[model samples]
Target: MRASKNRSQKSEVRSQNPKTYEIHISGAEGVYEDAEILKIVKEYTNRALNHPKGKPDNIVITLEQIKQIPQKVPMLPVITLKCNSPDKAKEMIFQILSDIGVPARTIKNSFKILTSPRTMRGAAIILKESGVRVEPDRERGVRVSRLGIEKNTEKILVRKLSKMKVSITTVKEALILASKVAAYTDVIAEICISDDPDYTTGYIASKRLGYIRIPNIKSHGQNYGGRVFIVRENTNINRLIKYLEKTPIIISGDIN
Candidate 1:
């Protein structure tokens, strides 16, 4: 019985065809140093191989250090509107989206989501004559879709923040991501409402208008906020999403 079991195990190992996956890992120097991260990876690989799902299939992870040539794209210029009241801010947002060819009905529907407390994950509304539909990526904060949109990894973003000479903050990161989405081929415009109770400001970004910030888009303590990406007609949703989420896009020091 012992000899037969040994033979079976050997046969299984020989017959197994291991699949390989190349995962790129990056991080800021101080926050998650390379050596420390590699250790974490090693630990996780062992945990995954022993996971309770079933008899673990073999998984081998290899890391290669490469000179990351980050694509430095220009940051959009800021165009702050002198609107303080939430109502006025709302009007301005509507007018801007309407001017950019977003249908009146779609704009209305999007605003509904922006104001709703339930839309914590935000949404991507595809513009089509047939009808507008919302796509959600709840698991991942708001990228194009589940495929994952690659905004700056914290490391790359930190480097860009230094180049731009700006204070690093979550709001800044959101704006940068918005700018990249605006530059995409089928994306007509983008609107972002801050969920922070203290922050009543929001912005709309697009290739045509740069980044337009509107203060008091919502009242303080209102607590509801989200993003809306107004995409163009007949867009290859999956492909556009892949570009938005997977491509390693970074913002440059140059503005406008």
Candidate 2:
């Protein structure tokens, strides 16, 4: 019996393939000092592999020593908007930092504290137009279809926050951070003013830039500062250099 069990175990080891996960790690903004972070990640990865109380069965992990990564191809310049928010400018700072495009895993649990309702009123309106009946369930506080009921509970409403405008002072700080993010990522993102004229000095440097803050319209805010634009006034080499240098930041976290 013992010999038979040993043979079976050996066969299983030979037949099963090792599951390897590839992870890329990068950080900026003065958070970690290399060795400390690498060690922490190494330990964390081990914990992930052996999650749920103890070491997992039939698993092997191999880690590579720290090595230099290759040069990065420059991404397009991101158009950055001056930040303004109602709540002590924290929102402005968050929007600016979001442009850095940190990997999603890092931010996944960050918003868990929020438990707000998600509304589908806009979708309900569209469905109503399409001849589909959308009924509101006051008990559940959500919209539902005539045939199949849809409900929302314990959800966060992100749209409502857009109403709060950031202060002008925060906008300047966010602008600096946005510039850094754009230069680092090499992707030019859109910059939308807060519908406040005070931001003109920050974004109205060129006529190619325009204002349209409608959230319902598909192309409303898309036409703002972005990758492709003609610089009409400056033809000199110095002007071109200056323009190239001031790449705006688009948050890597979102497609927009």
Candidate 3:
């Protein structure tokens, strides 16, 4: 079997802020034993930590094991959440964030990004968990992936997923990743809407609220959904990225 592993790191910006890093694992199309996967993760993570940049403040790991199924599963109906007015929907969303300790200014900006027409595909918004930018400008929120989950705090996630009945190994793996991100030093909360055309639900996860599902966060046939992560200022962007790409975290706790 021909399998290839890749590792690389880049700065999120040239400024003095702590740089963000990414370590990606791909090009493997065959199944391997669990011990083998763990070995790969440890070996790479050690290399990253030993680099000249020094040890990262946090670490997270993701393993996307690809598999093919012969048949397609049917899509479920969109979970519709009714509201009395247009603002009501926004209010409810804002309330969830507020209840979970997201700053007032951050909440407003996150909502703008979520509803904005310019929100791009294949990307999520990253904002300071404690800032007060008057508008939802790009500087206020960066369009990036793998940052919110450190692409969303990993700790806030485990509590949410731990309560669910996740049978699929992939789903459980994802939940563990989110949990790890939420637990980082600077991370605080995360909200996500699936970009899948067939899926219409979204979720808000934090250390306080656990995982609360929003039944109808998006519309069927619409593919504009995304994720938002709120984190503390001056967080090391490079260190966070390294964790997301390099760490190999196991699916802990009882996943029934």
Which model scores highest in TM-score? 1
- Expressed as tens digits, the lDDT of each residue in 1-256 for candidate 2 is 0000012333455666634422111111111234555664665455445332233333333333323322221222224443343232324423432544322322222221111122111111101012222223211212111110011100111222233343332332233333332342222232322211122322311211222121211122221111111121222423333323322222222111
**How high is the lDDT of residue 111 in model 3?**
67
lDDT of 1 by residue, 38-136 (tens): 675765565444432222344444443424444555666666788979889878887887776777787787787788764343345656343376465
Model 1: weakest 10-residue lDDT segment is 22-31
Error of 2 at 209 (Å): 9.0
- Candidate topping lDDT: 1
lDDT of each: 0.59, 0.25, 0.46
RMSD of each: 13.4, 21.9, 14.1
Order the candidates by lDDT, highest first — what do you get? 1, 3, 2
- Candidate 1 lands at a TM-score of 0.62
Candidate 2: TM-score?
Answer: 0.17
State residue 193's C-alpha deviation in candidate 1, in Å.
0.5
lDDT of predicted model 3: 0.46
Q: Please give, for residues 133-228, the per-residue lDDT of candidate 3 as tens digits.
A: 322444223322221122123353445445554323223333443455565556667667654445555666654555455656766665455557
